[model samples]
Target: MGLIAEHNCSMLLMDHVPKLLVSSIPDSQVVKNINCGRTKTAQIIKMLKIEAENELVQQLTKRKREREREREREREREREREREREKRERERETTKEEPEPAVTKKKNYEVDLAILKIIDEDSAGVSGLDMPEIFIDFNNSSSNKLLLLDEITEFSVLVVSVENDLEENILTETKVSST
Candidate 1:
């Protein structure tokens, strides 16, 4: 108030207030300390933001890798199962050569059940800021806890989208066009 009254210039009040205060303060050390503190605060906030982003990226990559590894392990199990079945059939054929011929039958492949990944989104508004809610595979049941979201963090989704297979010759063969 004193600085503003003395200066008699209230134009761009916010921009002038800091300068006026700095000018009024006799000690340069005080001004330097204030500027240094502001700079440090800004740097800390920036570093925190960067760290948060890096952590998110790392988590996403880890989830993707785990899913890939699990899929690969499942595929390998199926392959091993098929190989064992083939080996048993070969052994049976060799031993039953002297026996009477049996009726031909189709062999059934082993079927495995897959678990569906679900994300609990209590909020209707999933989109926050410019970035969309990141899709994550949460195996644990989150029924007991409430969905928490911050300004930097949004809700999780399953990332389901509509897709159609378009053949290469379809455009030329069908001649799809809007009138």
Candidate 2:
């Protein structure tokens, strides 16, 4: 017979083998041989099916383990990125909060005073005396004092002194107006 016909005959035999064994007389020696062959074929098919199921289960378990590991790696990467971002934000806030320069404190005060001086009627007007604007600077813990001399129809003289409570010297300018 040709190869195709032989294969078909074998397939037909395999299909009928179980039925033939079931219908044969139990005491016959030929039936015992056929039953043994059928039991071996059924055992082989069951073994193959079990092996296929085991392989499939192993593949699925391996894939699940790989997927879990990938997810863990992704989570670690995200946590690292979040930490880096928080560190950068902290650095930015620190840079933005710069220290300010120290400033010295000081107190200021002002006083105004008027003075009148008596002149002798026998004294003539003084000549060749020029009155000019005066500026003085000094340092003291006491208050300032001013003295003015007014002469009748003659030139006037003014004296000013300032006291400073600070560590630095104080500057004072005095201007005298005549009426």
In the range 34-97, model 1's lDDT, one tens digit per residue, is 2224454455335434654665688799999999999999999999999999999999999978
Cα lDDT for residue 95, candidate 1: 90
Structure candidate 1, residue pairs in collision: none
In candidate 2, stretches whose alpha carbon ends up further than 4 angstroms from where it belongs are 1-36, 100-179
Each model's backbone clash number: 0, 0
Cα deviation at 77, candidate 1, in Å, is 1.1
The weakest ten consecutive residues by lDDT in model 1 span 170-179
Local distance difference test scores for all models = 0.41, 0.46
Q: Tell me the spans in candidate 1 whose CA falls farther than 4 Å from its real position.
A: 1-42, 99-179
